[model samples]
Target: MENFFDQYRDEVQPALKSKLEEFILFGYDSVTEEELWQYLCKKKWKREREAKLLYQIVNDILSVKIGEYMNFATVEAFKSPDWFGNQGKDELSKLL
Candidate 1:
């Protein structure tokens, strides 16, 4: 019944937003978004660099948004905490 964003939005977006905001703002919030982001990422400090970082952050948000409904196929089943159920086992076994 739960959708993709619905599942991960609650889990991923907040953390991503917080990290991105922190990555942009850090301990201080006096500077503008463009200024802070460049200083943090150590980019070219140009208009385009700022714009690119902004774009990447938004794109990361989308990835985190969809990743909520997703599962990590690379992780082994027996090594995973939630692997006791059949949901991850069969899929993982097929990979090995």
Candidate 2:
């Protein structure tokens, strides 16, 4: 059976590649793609402010404090798919 990361790569990674690339650039050639994927799984960056979220990971690697904010548009795009999927749905409707 495929592991979580394996499944994630096959499913989510293709769609998320560009955003993941943006995160990888901060690693300065030292961070491997696998490492970034592991980190994403560990940190849940997709569920929240991913740019700011990415900054936290990058900052740890670089030993610098930066990337304090992300604009609304980026935040909207970065939220977890589960969160976005519920945006137009009503809880009461689901309950009925």
lDDT of each: 0.40, 0.44
User: In candidate 1, which residue pairs clash?
Assistant: 8-68
For model 1, state the Cα shift of residue 44 in Å: 24
Give lDDT tens digits, candidate 2, residues 1-96. Answer: 323344335544443455445545776344345654545554444354333433354443333212421232246447657652554457746766
lDDT of 1 by residue, 7-96 (tens): 334344454555455534544333333332323233222234223444554455434322221222122234457744687788888899
Q: Candidate 2: which pairs clash?
A: none
* C-alpha lDDT of residue 45 in model 2: 42
| Candidate 1 Cα outliers beyond 4 Å, as residue runs | 1-52, 64-69, 73-78, 81-96
RMSD of candidates 1 onward, in order: 16.5, 14.3
User: Against the true structure, candidate 2 has what lDDT?
Assistant: 0.44
For model 1, what is the alpha-carbon lDDT of residue 5? 30
lDDT of 1 at 71: 27
